[model samples]
Target: MSSTRVSGVVVTPVAFADPPLLNVVGVHQPYALRAIVQVQTDSGSVGLGETYADDAHLARLAAVADVLPGLDVYDLNGLRQRVSDVLRLDGSAQVGGMLAIQNPADVVLSPFEVALLDIQGRELGRPVADLLGGAVRTEVPFSAYLFYKWAAHPDREPDAWGAALDPDAIVTQARRMVEEYGFTAIKLKGGVFAPDEEIEAVKALAAAFPGHKLRIDPNGAWTPATSVRVAKELAGVIEYLEDPTPGIEGMAQVAGETDIPLATNMCVIAFDHLKPAVLADAVQVVLSDHHYWGGLQRSRLLAGICETFGLGLSMHSNSHLGISLAAMTHLAAATPNLTYACDTHYPWKTEDLIKPGALDFFDGSIRLPTNPGLGVELDEDALGRLHEQYLACGIRSRDDTSYMQTVQPDFTRNTSRW
Candidate 1:
């Protein structure tokens, strides 16, 4: 009956593609594929975890395999502490900090802990939400990210226009996403696309999706002054502006200058990261992506802290695939102050990465899966196919910085990927 019996950890490459049936923007991406980590116990229950960064991350995880391979499987808390130990030793310091001696990498530990959490949930015979505490709600509302470039013709570069996006196209997609995909809330990609363009796009979207929540992500593409001007300009048009300024102080400036909620997603990765942003009252939404701030358990802890502060919590998605999506859904289900809808990345994709029905959206909402563990089964065949594709293309390097430069949307230099 013990869940702790150790089996082994297997990490593999997966080039997760969106369901081909759905196309956004114009790029039918095999977007950025992530490495999937599976932790299987002697009991035959397998837990899933994914590393979203590039291939170099796999090397980072390799450093800690020896430390984890034979550890007791049932002790989730101990596994968490072990991961912390690795991060302390191998993690990056900050802002281009050097890797410390024997410092186990933080990126590696993230997926490691995720796999362990998956295993823990299986052993406990409950969803990860139950393992965290309990569920606050079974279903979570969704907010769609409308990346203009993805829907535009390949020749139409929105970033080059310094902020101009196609008005007619914006209106068309807004209507389609809401009506076809059941998206109740939407976040328009702003900044690098011109300021006027961003404003116009929002105006068009607002007109189309009224009563539906709307927010703008400049990706920190504007100066504090520009952010203020724009936030006020779109006053009644948008619900909030995410990372308007380049950093935390800029967010405070924007928040102070306007009534629209200023969401700080890029500034905080953990509770400690919240200090500067919260002290400045720079944002209303505390957006934390599990990949950045460790994993699910830690993210939930941060959400609780936000609750105490009367701050909003929206889990930021890194345009990730199934496993991460499932994990986030569980966290959202458990959190108490989850008011705003977080971005749901799966339904927007062109392909089914995992089971066909891991998470389903109905009329703009996704229910926390009631199934055991993360409630979705993994598709080994699809994962393998994508993995081989990446390998064949010789694009499996862990160097995501290079990959990003090639594919990232045209957000101004000020845009931040939190």
Candidate 2:
């Protein structure tokens, strides 16, 4: 058994300098990615995890620190239960507590979860997936995200980014993902680029790879009206429209108006988030990101709701490396109702991941872990190198990244981190 008592947590930030370039929501900015939360314990055994997007994740981490000084490392269930009870007692909301530890909204949670699970696996001498519920399929299919733009007005910034992306770049990237890396499905960025131009691009790419499945995610950049119009235009060409509307109500309206399947990348948060939409039969597909929900369990909860509502399940891929992608692949493999292709785009991050046997993207599908507890060991050397790179870059801002050092959440003011 390991001898570490959890002491401190560290946040590492990474850059998406080589992000998939495309117009999104009218703006163009390199998609920024934050790394995992490194949990340092007394025994010198470090446990890594990801935090949720808000102060809640920080707060949750801080809360964990409060309880970590003496908590036994091997008792993960006890540790989780303690943290959960504290969250419930504090009335900080169910989503943020566990989710905070696993899916920090700002960073993809899979890396952090993998880190923790890796530590656990090492401690128990097993693979991460074994900790959850033995693996079902060691391989899972992936849909690479062709383009990304994350800004208030994302669709308007392609020219500002300077170099115009050649249409051939899309073909080459798609070809590499398929021919070189073996991806079966590809998701191109849409909704933010000029409507006509975007439609043309989708058409060209769809025709380019007739055998591969094609999907488009606007990232909630289009209005319901535009979504319906675009869906009609892309009908018989595109597979589904993701987050075509900014809101669930809009989705319902679009669902009523169109025959094409309306999927969602956003707007599906938790079980509660799915209720009204599911009841309305607005969503045909559900794309739940662990980064948004926090961990697999919460993601499972969201999936449970999707299954109950008879909605399709697919996960969103943040700009993550191998460790997180492998964890996500396992979750996808385990899920029963995951029919539509999943957005697991870690292959775009790089060829070599920081973990071993975490994922093997072969012929358009990634193999899930047959080992126990998230099933990938972190390459400490690689992690350290990446961490140092982040420190050298200014993007590692933990304090000044937000408008407020500590924004007062409008709800009941908890004296915690957020």
Please list the C-alpha lDDT of all candidates, in the order they appear.
0.67, 0.59
Q: How far is candidate 2 from the true structure (C-alpha RMSD, Å)?
A: 7.7
1-418: candidate 1 lDDT, tens digit per residue:
3436656777876654432111111232334567788887777878888865354566556556646766776565776666666555533432111111133344456677777777777767788889878998888888877665443223443222122238777676667677766888898766545678778878888777778888887667677888878877898887778877666777787788798887866666545557777788877888776776667777777877888787887867655677888888888888778778987665455554587776777777778887878887888887778778667655453332333345655512334322
Off by over 4 Å in 2: 1-16, 23-31, 39-47, 51-63, 72-116, 148-168, 350-358, 396-418
Q: Which ten residues in a row have the lowest lDDT in candidate 2?
A: 409-418
Over 75-185, each residue of candidate 2 has an lDDT whose tens digit, in order, gives 555566655554543323223221222222312333344456656765676755566665566667778667633222223443222332445556766776677667667
Best by TM-score: 1
